[model samples]
Target: MKNVSADAINALKAQCRGEVLLRDDAGYEAARQIWNGMFDRLPGIIVRCVGTGDVIKAVNFGRDHELLISVKGGGHNSAGNAVCDDGLMIDLSLMRRVNVDPKKKTLRVDGGALLGDMDDESQLYGLAVSGGGIISHTGVGGLTLGGGFGWISRKHGLAIDNLISAEVVTSDGKLLTASAGENPELFWGLRGGGGNFGIVTSFVFKCVAIGPEVYSGLIVKKFEDAKEYIKFHRDYVRTLPDDMTVWMVVRHAPPLPFLPNEVHGKMVVVVPFVWLGNEAEGKAFIKPIQEATPSHGEAFGMNPWVGWQSGFDGLVGHGARNYWKSHHIKGLSDDCIDKIIAFGDTMPSPECEIFIPHMEGAPSHVPADETAFSYRETPFVLNIHTRWQNPSDDKRCIAWARDFHAATEPFAKGVYVNFLSEEGEGRVKEAYTEAVWERLVQVKQKYDPQNLFRMNQNIKP
Candidate 1:
């Protein structure tokens, strides 16, 4: 078998233009590593694709060789579906380029480009497509496919909402483009659909005018004020207009200087917001949040969008152990708030945090079935993220997150597949309802009947 695999690798080398890393290659070790340390799969080969042509060759080679295949964009998936065991791993990291057409206010991005890269390039023109949150390092592929959320989401919608078109490579090793006018069914599936249908090489997105600078910052309140802060948040968020978006977290406060020493490692509601308007208007919009509750200390000010993008840099990263669970709730009822606060108070690790962000904005107004994102009507989404630095603490962190989700699932209206772990097909189907699930299955069959794009939160074709 080893000899046969080696011969197949040689055959691929002769047909491909880019480099391929076998098990013994130095690059193989690096290529196999994903954002989540929990996954440690050793693929037979890691093909670092330099272009769409290389991607096509790699896909066909893997299919012909009967090897399991995984497509990695930014390699940021918590489930580590980016690489597989004893299969062909197609790494798209080298295809990082962004072409922004300022005149059309549109941007074309290589699927491997990170949100940070997209923001950095787009912001130069005082324009930005909707992108994932600050950790800017998140790949465009995973984020966009799984319904991206970030600072500008309130104004523009999910990252998928801004996607105008995409160039995808199908299972048959053919390059195809999908948009509203062409391959419309495939286009709909690409948005929030996860990477279940094809390999997206390039995506064209409609850019919106936004920050060179924006009024965005954070406010921290003590642990004792968790309930009050949440209550105030619920009401305050309801009143805020579409131009403002805020996400509140109750967690052990990181020991930043602005955070009082006594408050570190204690539960607190870290309220972060980005107001998309003039300073005066933005300040007016945020005034009530400050007056509504007694905050521990505030980090409020005007900053560049990139600075605001970096605000959560301390929170998100690759290589850390990631176990994520999430819920989309219709509202923050008292029972739900109590459950959240209870878990918040007993957070198992400093890195363990609960996120509840309002979803009732212009972005949320879109029909649930319009795209692959089906939970927009869900008023709030809660994320229980358990992140730790050491493998020894893995079980503890995962148990804490799972328990939190189990306790709160009764109040949850739906689940966000992007933040989910490998819970199996039933859970995947639950992420979309019977009707939506049926449609997704049909679309999956249409574009990828062989299920070649099953590497993601797979919807079986």
Candidate 2:
């Protein structure tokens, strides 16, 4: 661990209201553990920030000490950038306070608030932002910084699109609120810039009226029918309305009550979707896919928005080794479909899956330069989610994901920064267009010239 004088540590502890944990501290081990188990790092110090004041203190301390700093929001990143081997880790897990304004149709979320926190509060007011991912435990801070997307993206646009403003603490420890009207340039960079500029303490987002409940569910298809079904799915989804989104995933069936026990461990193609409109129309829109391929098992109907958001939580629970390789494709061609099916057939682990989410609706309508998230016109995002529980299986799981990624690279236009693992700088560049990257560099130079916050998918000054 990097050496810090006891006096200095005590001074930090005195200044901050939150916990300052050392390696031997009671909760140190638990505080340092992030979502991805593959990263077993031991940070020299962990500041469990309880509020913006605590965050500012931690930031100032890390900068003064010239320590490598990693910021942990929900700690759900696949790359495990939330922790470092020997550095200062600012843990925001304790600051999860979410406030909703039903009249204004807006919500203000703390940096540490999880998607579930936001969803639970917003749904109470019959309002929701468009961009949190399917998993409810994802951090609002990291996900929004990386240009979040999920069930409602097609209708409402990316998380960045709905972002009204943010309260940011820069490298110099100056707290500033960025919005379209205030610090517009920095606001643009924050949209999809991944955590390069600074630490965001809280976020203000515009919410759309979605649901107390909506129509959504999963349909499982046998692997034998994946090839043809996927092709038809690709063509069929193009005709879908903006209010509906259907994503395809290939993986071994999990032991859910809906599926027979015999098919539990078998490879299958699962089509999961959410419709923000009327139940009758949603059913009519989803009818073609159900009729196109024979399903092994299926479940579809009206579910509480919160319930559907957390439905897959069991499958993606924390404490697993994860390696993700992703690509942004304009369209799913025949060759790409074949490669995806082949990889699905030989999945290294039951937890591994090939996720193809259709992208392109409200987000696509925005100009590329409008926000740092430049892949606005891309039609599909292909993510190779390689997951397993054992250190012994790491090599095989990672190799499988890498090979599958390489096989599908020819059809890729770019990639999503959030889905990236520790793939180097070149892959990072792929996340942004050249023009947007240059602009981000300018913002970084102005706010973080010393690159104090370089732990994330970095955009260096």
For all predicted structures, in order, the TM-scores are 0.97, 0.99
Error (Å) of candidate 2 at residue 459 is: 1.0
lDDT of 2 by residue, 371-444 (tens): 99978889899999999999999999989999999999999998899999999889999998999889999999
Model 1 agreement with the true structure over 1-461: per-residue lDDT tens digits? 24245677788888777789888887788888898888989988888988999999998887776677899999988878998988788999989899999999999999888888888898899998874655777889988888887877877788888888999988888899999998988888888788888899999999989878888888887778778878878888888877888889888788878877887777788888888888889888878888877888888777898777766776776787889898787788889889988888777777877888777775677877788878777778898888888988888888989888998888887788888788889788767767788889999999888887777898988
TM-score of 2: 0.99
Those runs of model 2 whose alpha carbons end farther than 4 Å from true positions after fitting are: 1-3
| Candidate 2 lDDT score relative to the true structure | 0.92
Q: Candidate 1 local accuracy as lDDT?
A: 0.83
List clashing residue pairs in candidate 1.
none
Best-matching candidate per TM-score: 2
Best candidate (score: lDDT)? 2
Please report how far candidate 2 places residue 201 from its true position, in Å: 0.4
The residue-level lDDT of candidate 1 at 223 comes to 71
RMSD after CA superposition, every candidate: 1.5, 0.9
